[model samples]
Target: MNPYFARSRNDRLAVGTFLFGTLLAVWYLMCVVLPHYQLSSDYVIYAHYATMTILYFQSLANFVMVTVARPDGNCKALQRNQQTESAHCDACGIVKPPRSHHCKVCDVCVLKRDHHCWFAGCCVGLRNHRHFVVMLTYLWLAAVYGNVLQWTFVGDQLGGHGPATWFRIVAPHVALLTGHVTAYQFFVAVMTFVGLLCLVMFSWLLQMQVVQIYHGQTQHERETAVTKYDLGWRQNVTCALGSRWYLVWISPWIPSPIPDDGYEYRTSAKTD
Candidate 1:
């Protein structure tokens, strides 16, 4: 009912749509156009198809998890006494859990709040942190893969035996499709540029997330110099990625159970 919540939801929906649509378009390009032009070997073509399929579905699952999985934000259940100082949020008038911070955009407290991602149009917090990291990882991989494939295809078209010019390569595809350089080819050209940019950006993001997880810190916690939640590297990674983390990259469908409930977490001081 709140305007802030409404605006945040709308932004999330719009961004999510854009992201999902972009990925779907890339999948179509890779599965449909790529194999026809780039590969002569059946094995390579089939492998490309399989790669695109996994990336598409995994990306979709990650996007869904990031969008729908919200923190409970109910601090009252954890608070045994009304007078507890850390138990109350002044803004939302709810009990605040440890490591939770109030997100102005979402208008609620988020458990283990990392950062409010404008691209995701949501707060990166407890329940969806794993999903967020996995999304970035897969998206980066997809971008890198797309860039390499596009580069090779463009090079072959441009009369170069290896990587070569952009316009000289793309102009033929555009002209063949519509007798002249049409919007479709232009769109592909733009995506080629975007793919490279995303490859670099997401690579940096994934690296940052890995470093943060290794040190058992969220973006907020790192800024605030809070290390109470640092539970050693392995346990910290396990906490973020869940139990079956090794298989998380292969597929989002794989069961990777988060150890904590978001409301309750084990700090460095406690063993149990």
Candidate 2:
């Protein structure tokens, strides 16, 4: 019996696959179903906005949850102590690089370890964090914007009725948009959905910008122990989303690469 199979590798693959499937299912339902049958305009709009907010919150929550390490104490102090070139992770038994954390489930030290995402069915580590973010941005907008478009179709289907019969006529359009869709139109539907998704994600990304301006923290700084926020907001943004978030799509946030042997495990030092 191979020990690696019984350890992190198998669990990671299984759990990761489950998460990926779940996200795919959700994407199908949100982007495909509701839009096909023509759900309510308000519902579609609300879902879009809600998804945007939720993604932002989820990203923030996931980042904070994993990187903070000991959420109870002065993480600042622990980080300060780790200022030397390298250190070990007590949990996963590896010497983590400067901004790395050990993931117990994956049983490896993930560089720039954000939270493990069930949506992508992968750890939001250095390798795929950007992809996951891009996916979220796409999914959120696809849900909301797509729904709004559906409402337009529903309205068109109804041919613009007046106040009295508007409610009655519009209600059916909503129902029709909600279900009975197939995979073929997915590409066409995704075009519209992706556009809206990008718009909303960009807007929220800007919002994260404004918040960071006042608080003076990057996504990376907020998550890890690299606390030199004095280097202007531009640098902070660059560090957070890479030097090119404003330029391209699809998880442009690039993380620093991890070392060859990976992080060392340090015994949790008992503080008196």
Q: In terms of TM-score, which candidate is strongest?
A: 1
Clash totals in order:
0, 22
- Over 1-272, each residue of candidate 2 has an lDDT whose tens digit, in order, gives 11212244655575465445435534644565456555568876576557645554454343332332231122333344444566766874444465566556545555555555433333554444434445455445544544454555434443443552244333433333654222333333443344444457556764554554333343555544334433455543344444464642522333432221112322222221
What is the total number of backbone clashes in candidate 1? 0
Positional deviation of 91 in candidate 1, in angstroms?
1.6
Prediction 2 TM-score vs. true: 0.42
Q: Single out the weakest 10-residue window by summed lDDT for candidate 2.
A: 259-268
Q: lDDT: which candidate is best?
A: 1
Root mean square deviation (Cα) for candidate 2? 12.4
TM-score for predicted model 1 compared with the true structure: 0.78
lDDT of candidate 1 over 101-134, digit per residue (tens): 8888787778788887767667788877888898
Model 2 residue 51 CA deviation in Å? 18
- Alpha-carbon local distance difference test for all models: 0.71, 0.44
